[model samples]
Target: MKTKKLNVKSRTENLSLIRDFVSSSAAEAGVTSDVIENIILAVDEACTNIIKHAYKSYPDGELIVKTKSTRNRFIISITDYGKSFEPDAIPEPDLQKYYRQKRVGGLGMYLMKTLMDDVKYVSIPGKRNEVQLSKNLKLTQQNVR
Candidate 1:
């Protein structure tokens, strides 16, 4: 397995840096372009949640994003020391409801689950909150079906 890690402040401005890091790392690991895009989107969503919800937009909060890649798998682990929430508590998105309520947002979790083969969350109270997003490197968009 090959591993790479990045530590960035939990700010909206750093989301692009996170995406770039993940994108280049996945490409170097030989992940397909389609899979790489999926991984990038999932990672961006995960980090955005960490910055907005966990860190509550505090610019000083730290975000640790680590990538571990093997022949068949690419995994991104994001850690935050701010706040943690229950992943299961989030309900499946209802697009109609959002349209009716004129609400935007709340789709990051849903998007992550849709784009990644594995989406896991671990929260240790008063410790850290981690989100692990992974995809099978061997699969292409067509192979996914």
Candidate 2:
């Protein structure tokens, strides 16, 4: 397995850096373009939530992003030292209601869950919160020409 890690301030400007890292890591893992794009989007959504929600009131907090790949899978893990969030507490958005109300926000978590093969969250009170997103590279690579 191969792994890479990055640490950045919990700010919006750092999103591009995170995207680039995820893209490169996914490519290295032999993930197809479509899968790589989805992985990037999922990671971005997770990080954005960490920055905008978990670290909302603590701008100086740090976010640690880790990318790992094995023979069969690619994974991205994001950790934050801010307010922990319970993944189960976030209900699946009702798309019909969202569209009827013309809501613009509250879609990040939904996108993350839908885009990645597996999404898991772990939060330790007063310690840290970690969100893990994984994609099965074997399946994705098999689709490549």
Candidate 3:
């Protein structure tokens, strides 16, 4: 499968671009509308985090979004050139505590992790950080619509 790459600056419009690409890719993969909505929401949250946290600290780097499709699956990789972040190290959001204190910052990553079936992260020594997400298409008769 060939991957689709999109390069955009850290701006609000790019978020929409990323969501559209991901959602369209999901539809092309024959995923149902519900699954497609999940994909869009997950991708949107990831992109928003990059804009707000990743590139927000540094105003010079561009965000990269790569979308790939297989016969029965779809993958989207978001790469940013800002400071390195360890997604694995982020502690799961304490829902109980947040429900009481109303904290922020970790919920976006939590939502992304929950919505996607597979999420992987790789940070090079001095290069950009990459987050790879994979989605498997369900083949039930009800899901084909």
Among all candidates shown, the one with the greatest lDDT: 1
Expressed as tens digits, the lDDT of each residue in 104-132 for candidate 2 is: 55688889888888999898989999999
Off by over 4 Å in 3: 57-60, 140-145
Model 2 — TM-score against the truth?
0.90
Off by over 4 Å in 1: 139-145
Worst 10 residues of 1 by lDDT: 136-145
lDDT per model vs. reference = 0.89, 0.87, 0.80
Q: What is the C-alpha RMSD of each candidate to the true structure, in Å?
A: 3.6, 2.7, 2.9
Worst 10 residues of 3 by lDDT: 136-145
Better candidate by lDDT, 1 or 2:
1
Q: Which digits, one per residue and each the tens of the lDDT, describe model 3 over residues 93-114?
A: 9989888987887898898889
Model 2 misplacement above 4 A: 100-102, 139-145
Pairs that clash in candidate 1: none
